[model samples]
Structure formats: structure tokens, C-alpha cells
Target: MTADSILNVRWRKASASDPFDNCVEVARLEDGEVGVRNSRFPSGPALVFTRDEMVAFIDGVKKGEFDGMTV
Candidate 1:
């Protein structure tokens, strides 16, 4: 999946989303890919992740794996 296919996607902010000091925005692409990019830079490059990868990352956040905490 490519950003071109994601352009028309209805982007929704994550329920637990926080404002981006770096102007970042995330959207779920139609092809089940996740698109992350800097809102400040509309034409900026985006990082794409598969649905499973995104879910794993979210699970890690909920478990605080990066903060030295396990839930």
C-alpha cells in the first residue's frame, strides 16, 4: 500500500492520541496499512506499518514496555 491510496482515507485520531509537538498525524489506510506523517509537512514522507505491526506497537504501549513497566 502507498500514500497515494491513503490520500482519500478518512483519517481519524487515535482515541488515546496526544497532540504532536512534531505535528505528526496518523491515519488507517484502506489496505489495512497505517500511515504516519508530519502534519506540518503535508508532502513529507510517511512511515507505513502493517495492521499486525500496528497492533503489536499499541499493545506494547498499553503494557508500558518502553517505560520499564509491564502490565
Candidate 2:
């Protein structure tokens, strides 16, 4: 969905986010897809991902599948 389209949606940030609000926000769209955008850029471009794709990504995160890149 376009960035403007989700402007009114309820976006949420991770519970662990710092007080400075430096984190991404996420929300579930009407079409069941997930919306993700940078908290620092509320009106910037957003990326839409399917449920399954998000699940896979989340699982990978839990398993630290992308840890190699961070090291």
C-alpha cells in the first residue's frame, strides 16, 4: 500500500524501543498484509509483506539467521 494510505492506520513499535523513538513501526492492514515503516519517517515509503513472508522473516530473526551480517 502507498504511504499515504496507511497514515491513519494504528502503527505500533516494539516494546523494547528506546525513549527517543528510534525504531520502525508495524501494523496490520485491512487486506491482511503487514505494513512496516521507519518510525523516524512516518510519511516515508512503506513496505508491504505477505503474512507467510513476515512469519518466515520473524522466525529467522528468532533464530538469528542474519547474525552473520551483524558481526
- Show pairs that collide, candidate 1: none
Candidate 1 residue runs with Cα over 4 Å from true position:
1-5, 14-21, 68-71
Q: Which is the leading candidate under lDDT?
A: 2
What are the models' TM-scores? 0.66, 0.84
Weakest ten-residue segment in model 2 by summed lDDT: 1-10
Cα lDDT, all candidates? 0.70, 0.85
For 9-71, candidate 1 gives per-residue lDDT tens digits of 654554554565345567887788889776656566778989999899989878877786423
Instruction: Please tell me which predicted candidate would have the highest TM-score against the true structure.
Output: 2
TM-score of 1: 0.66
